[model samples]
Target: MIARAASALLVASWLVVGPTPAAQAAPATATCTSSVGPGIPPPAGLAAGVPGFHAQWYGQSGYPTLCPGERSTATVAYYNSGSRGWVNGRMGEVAYLGTWGPEPGQDQVTPLGGDGTNGSPATGWPRYNRIAIQPAPYVGPSQVAWFQFTIQAPVQAGSYRLYLRPLVEGATWLEDFGVFWLVTVLNADGTPPSPPAPPVLGTGYGFQNVATARGTFGVHLVKERLADVTVKTLTANTTECLNNCPAKPLAQYAAETNAYAGMNGTYLCPPDYAACAGKVNSYDYAVYNSTLRRWLNYNALNGQNGLLAFNGTTTSVYRRSFVYFQQQTPVTAAITNYPLLLQNGAVISSEAEQSASQLAKGTKGAIGVDGTYVYLVIATNANVTDLAYVMQALGARDGLNLDGGGTAAMWIGGSYKVGPGRLLPNAIVLTKP
Candidate 1:
């Protein structure tokens, strides 16, 4: 099931196209079989032994990025490869696309659709769990049907996936074609929403007191020419894991790599949260593991997150996209994070869509670069916006926000300066070559 699903996603990635306008509403009903034409090839790789009802994926519209409460049209095409004909509104014969995957069941209700009371992003779906049905009343074998639907992005800013499969209501599910859509939600200005608050700082951690124009911050900072230190991203696991993943403290990461300085890497699903039960400690950002010479969660490299990379002594900061970095080679270290705090020495973190925790005074962490020098900082009693000012005050040309709250931590010269806070799955480390 996993292999087939991956293959389907790979195919979809190649055929992505820009969003099209919402399709016109279909007439009450129509005969679609007559539209079948000659020279059309049969779909390849139909599931065997499921002659009664089967489907072959044809094509789908491009994935879209939307703001909260915004809506967009989406379409998917499929070829009927089964022996039976689909009849509209007929029990045991009507074909419909239902939510599936990321789980142990099918026909699950997705938050992207349904009545407003069901935590749906928007209303007007055929049903909470149903995405769409074939536009025509009957679809004969070898005929292709187009399914159109609307997707409303949720209020939260993050990437969301909706898995779908075709089935005849009250009958067996069709072939597992492994179809899904990836939607990204950001603020109206295209900035990431503020993250959740970090845990309160514990006493006795050593930090340099620095006062900036924005506010005072207790910081664990390092200023070194790139040539003097090799920066690398280290991970506890060699590969990705959804839950029960290996994680270790900042000191352990520093010791293992002989790193002189280190800090937490990215936002993650913490084990303590009830919502993280099935996927504890799983993070979705891309990070290149220097020791392994590979990217974990590599698929996320194509997203709109902020990326910081080091190619030997050359450091590059990407504010919104990783396409350019994707083509670069020989990168010694790399990590992606959200809501780029500073760009070109100017504050850029958005105040829009900031949660109460993000706006409230709390601990915040960030990594930044100025000229040939790099910096690691953990500020006290601050907000996301304050981090930008702090980075600017530190003379950073560009900066990116790291994981904060309980996940915030930093180590320097064989000991922790900010935290031995929470265990980390990944960390950015600096070591002498």
Candidate 2:
């Protein structure tokens, strides 16, 4: 009788009203489970032969699996080898790409890893499954595979789950699988996205409405904009404004407010790097500083604004014009006592070694500060209201419109906030004192 009733409900749910609510609802009690078995081990001592890699299932333990538009209920973790041997000189780094469903197609993903880097190893090898003429030779005696994906609540208002397994020699390698780590994605930020609508601001060259100044506003910090400026040298005791224009000369420096001629003033760039700077489209970038233990960016609130927090210090917090950002790993690592950087967004020539288009047009992703909290946004078919809400809910006290239309991105700042090392034209910087 219960089975018949369930079948009737299923049929009525499918035919009579909208979609099936039960089908869309997340599983109330789900657990992630897995087992492991030994396989042909690595030959011996070579770093490549180390047993750091293992097969594991994510979310097999009890947790809510997530998808876009679904509230984050669980956080899952995967681990690499215990030591550094798992990482190669520059070739053996982790790479990831997202998808709508567990199918073999690059529908939403880009041809390359968003940028030209291709995220290929030293010998043009991908860390996970590869699609080419033939499988790239795995010279090492052993090989490990990793898979990652996330689900957001607003993207789809339905309960969803994903199953991950390894593929070997065109076959499913389920027996050798083992369980590794698992974490939970939670609603740390109580806010949710508002439905979509037209953008609050317009698409113009100059910005007229600066962030509200009525309240105690923090210093106006712009990500690095490549612009020209007048240079002046001041004496130790002379705390006066001094300006030396390229052609004309003056002894007084312009005040921060005066820098803008007036509302709709012509966009300006700093006199540092000669790349296009000033008033980029809606977007912002933040870099995680391990030493300072905070997210760092150009602080426009300070009086003297030259690389405000460059060279291992966060004291310089002023000298911003607009904002820009690049995507990077969630944590920071050290090579020469300096953080390891990479490209994860848009590709522009002036961006230096950074990939100019790491997070460019129409792409959607999430960002979090402390590992326990996170916020995800959907670019495609998402309204500005919803976007604003999600960001705020995720602890973005003050956030800006990152380049969207696929260029949107976020990195989990569990350890170090990944940084794309170029100045964006416009960015929304956070101001939490």
Give candidates' CA RMSD values in order.
18.1, 21.8
lDDT of each: 0.68, 0.22
lDDT of model number 1: 0.68
Candidate 2 lDDT trough over 10 residues, lowest sum: 333-342
lDDT per residue as tens, model 2, 198-259: 22222111111112211111111112111221111111112111222111111111122122
Instruction: Point out the worst 10-residue segment of candidate 1 by lDDT.
Output: 31-40
Quote model 1's TM-score: 0.51
Task: Find the candidate with the highest lDDT and give its number.
Answer: 1
Q: Best candidate, TM-score-wise?
A: 1
